[model samples]
Target chain A: MHIQATGNVYRAKAVTGIKTVTDILMFGAGGHAAAVSDVIRDIEDFNISGVIDDSPSLQGKCLFGSTVIGGRQQLYMNGLDTMAIFLGIGDNLTRARIARSLGGREFPVLVHPTAHIGTNVSLGEGTVVMPRAIIENGARVGAHCIINNGAVVGHGSVVGDYSHVSGNAVLAGGVNLGERCLIGIGGCVLPNVAIGQDSIVSAGSVANRSAPERHYIMSPGSRIFRRFEK
Target chain B: MHIQATGNVYRAKAVTGIKTVTDILMFGAGGHAAAVSDVIRDIEDFNISGVIDDSPSLQGKCLFGSTVIGGRQQLYMNGLDTMAIFLGIGDNLTRARIARSLGGREFPVLVHPTAHIGTNVSLGEGTVVMPRAIIENGARVGAHCIINNGAVVGHGSVVGDYSHVSGNAVLAGGVNLGERCLIGIGGCVLPNVAIGQDSIVSAGSVANRSAPERHYIMSPGSRIFRRFEK
Candidate 1:
């Protein structure tokens, strides 16, 4: 099996040609993890074996009725190759770091039943699409990304690896987002606009034009989009 | 049947005690009409008899495979009581005017199959909830309102009559919106903020505080919400 790599951002692919339901392990135990667990339950294609959070306090605890078995060290247990890992972390940087460190593991893409994913859309592995999100036709979302609740990735839009498109945000048609970026809650990226790597389109902000790496795009006044120093 | 009335906005209740499938008439034939048609097709409860548009050119034309039967005058033709009227107009005042002019008609509430309407939610008659919109638990949406695509009315929020919550907007939990209000596209109203009647929260803006009647709320700079002259 050939795997692609870029820095710490490895591009994971969906497990294909599998006949039976697979046992999946969740990698984090946060609010986003709970949401992903809900989606997993809704999808019903995989059995959630247990949660694997690194925190010692969460050890032996429960998340959404799933037992928190242990930390990442548990992945090395018997039958590791058969069990798939789900990236449930919400932070982009931390998720990307985990993805890079944890190599050669299957990361299946999970999408909620209520989400509207149009034809010709491509979702990379480890990406979790929340309930009621709309991914219009011909859109592409990269690996380990979080397309949060009711977010709209417009037609032909491309979201890079480890990005988070927050709740109720709208990336207009043909918009492009680089890796590790965040399109905040209720954020609006105008049609065909491209946002660079590590940039943040602040909550309730609008991005009308393209911006460079590590910039902060926000709305200054009514219906205006401007770039400010981060 | 005892029907309740409040000025021009009579609260139309959902048709009850009907065993057989009923025919439904769409009231408008614009872009919003097209979206409402999509939702109707998804729900598959009522048969769409035809469309009623005021435009002369649209007469005899087809909307989502349904014939544009005629204007409001055609409603007087035959068997009107059996057929239910769906408010498909996007404009608040226009929809309210038509609702007022056409009295003694049954207006059933329409919600899309993809939408997540939480427990204890109360949706009034003639209200159309578009695809992927979310109405959280205990929320109340008044008569003839439009909850557009991917919009979110948070938990326990109350939205009044004839209002339009546009695409991707988010009204946080406990928010109250008065009649004929417009929460524009990508707008975010903070938790417990009460917007007055006929008020407008501009697109991509955020309302952190409550405002009185007929005012405009907009977000300036990154996260500050303020009132402006409409």
Candidate 2:
């Protein structure tokens, strides 16, 4: 109400929704971490407050001006609900472990604009779907999941929470993922197969049949080879 | 005139376009065959008239009602323009061999609807992008390429024709792909590396260094490997 200030024009601040200023904790320090950080940066409402990693070399390093903190050796991020934690880990097994350590905390699910998620699809809280991750019609995803970059959750699939479908993994129609399951990088699960929870399907494997709760290591030939060569 | 006589429906033949078919001999018949067959079946334009394979077990099987004619020691579709050949091989090195054998024929490029191709992205004829494949902004994809399921071509990346980026492979920004290159399953190429044409990066490899060609391979830990271990 100051009449003398009429000649001076001030650039107006853009009005935003009431729920602004979301804080986020990123879970990795590698290239994938850097990439996810960029994605979180693109979102207007969220700000990456910090990163959690076990790498001593990166513990004090500045990642886009955020300090890297340590967590449970496996669960490298403190699951404090005051801020949402994102699983920047690309590996499924590690992601599942981290998700469990964060036990029952509210994880904010982030779906990138470029992604195409269809109707009748249920995505759990705290899951992050990168650009081009297509969740087709009739898909059910559980809580605390990580749908990595370019992954495909085909029609009529069920993925439990605390699971990580690695970057580029393809789960064909009607594939059932038990809780905390790990579908490794580029793994292909054919239609109608059920993977038990807490199980790890090795990277590059082609799963056409149901498997129990354990590590199903695949050889270079995409076959069920001997157990993982430690 | 026929509506009353034909059970309340006109029986006139539905007018349809006769798509220009690519005369081709299909090679490989497995999971990749299932996907390629699905595409071929969906696109009535290309008549995938027959299939050829060296596998004794699959030699006589029918793929999507199309019979497997014979082994493809040599290209043979009997000069039918309605058929254009496509390689249904999953792995990269195997496809390279198949590509060499079918040098004279034309392969039509197939792009799935779920793919998000960005601006200034140039894709050559005969390249196929499976579902959820993302060819980002400023990417130039060359001829005879196979950008498999859920693969990512980052912005400003240049992939030469005849190169195959296997399912879920990730190429970072400004990367250069040489001609006839084969990037294996789940491989990740770091930013700004120029991979020489005709080279093969092994599956699960993460290439941080530039790969000079003739022939070269790399593993995930950035160790030197081979394209095909005999």
Candidate 3:
């Protein structure tokens, strides 16, 4: 029997002698892709078929036992129904755009078995809940988000679409993150706080108050500024 | 068969027919208690008898399907030998004081089943390692401590008695935290850093330097101050 979760529901498929493992194609060739490959290997349910990267230099290179087969256009050439797709990009905006490009394609939610998700927690399509991450009761993690290793989504917290809650970052109770936000490594959002769309709370920073759209909230007393704006 | 783990030891008790489940009493009636209740429910080997809180306002209130029984005096009035106790208080100081008040009482360590405790890690009596928490190789966590949800005690770290390592906090390799310290939410203690007794590193703060006793360290450029002092 092979158990696979699609969307938020799990279904067990009966197979004869050996289990039928699914083929999963990784959609990036960077450091984040390497980490996701490790997690996919650890899961043992899927075989990494190949890696897809737009960078010309990465083509034909190997990562996590799979070769970089081709560029982003190859995803369209190959049948999308033949294998599962996992978003391996860490940047929220890039990931969101790639996800939009692959519109309506099957991107199963990949939750590492070690992750502890509490009652009534909803993980959206293509979201990856990594090792030792905790999504507490009533939390809703949006589509294509990465709830990274050892991260915590406190009770009733809302993580918006394509947001990346990095390793050991915390979203305390009732905190709301807008689309494409990056809660960096070991960062924390206090209870009931709201961070707007495209905001980046830098590594090791504390977000105690509400932040506006497109702002970068760095170290304490440092000015919050819009990215790419002088 | 009933298997119970104490410290680093697991003992199995043979029982005829149905397995014996231990009754556990929660020591606090707060948000943390609700979280711990969910973990206890997930474990299945333990049953929550009720919650004990000293607050007069919350004495009869129900939380997570369990009613708050009475004051601290009820603990002694009821037979302590019958059930195990789990500290659900989030504050290190209050938990320490309550543990001391319940002198000589048995407080079994509660580790969430999903928590990853690596080789040779030692968790002391009354310590609660919450869901998805990681105690890496050779780490030692002392008695009556809270290793909150998704917190990571890195390789060879030593967490002292009555300390509270909050959700998603990271104690990097070889870090040492003294008794009654609070490593706040998403706080990161750099490799080999030592925090003295009764100290607190606020949420999302990085502790790169050794902190003295009874001080609160918040943001960069902020002077550490004693709790009672202005």
Instruction: Tell me, per candidate, how large a share of the native contacts it keeps.
Output: 0.30, 0.09, 0.36
TM of each candidate vs. truth:
0.59, 0.50, 0.72
Give the best candidate by lDDT: 1
- Name the regions of candidate 2 deviating beyond 4 angstroms: A1-21, A69-81, A200-204, A215-230, B1-150, B153-180, B184-197, B201-230
The candidate scoring highest on TM-score is 3
Residue pairs with colliding backbones in model 1 are none
Q: What does the lDDT come to for candidate 2?
A: 0.65
**How does model 3 score on DockQ?**
0.23
**Model 3, residue B94: C-alpha shift (Å):** 3.8
Cα lDDT tens digits for candidate 2, B176-224:
9998787887876766888876677777765656766655555424457
Instruction: Compute DockQ for each candidate against the true complex.
Output: 0.17, 0.06, 0.23
- For each candidate, what is chain B's TM-score? 0.86, 0.71, 0.84
lDDT order of candidates, best first?
Answer: 1, 3, 2
Residue pairs in collision within model 3: none
Query: What tens-digit string does per-residue lDDT give for candidate 1 at B1-230?
Result: 21222111211222322333468899999988888888778777767899998799999998887999999998888775557889899988899999988877778777776676654467777788787787764578998899998898876689999999999899866899999999888788866889888888887788877887778876654456677967
Poorest 10 consecutive residues by lDDT, candidate 1 chain A: A2-11
Model 3 ranges off by over 4 Å: A1-21, A49-83, A220-230, B1-21, B38-44, B51-82, B97-105, B113-124, B131-142, B149-161, B168-179, B186-197, B206-213, B221-230
Question: How many clashes (backbone atoms < 3 Å, residues ≥3 apart in a chain or on different chains) does model 2 have?
Answer: 9
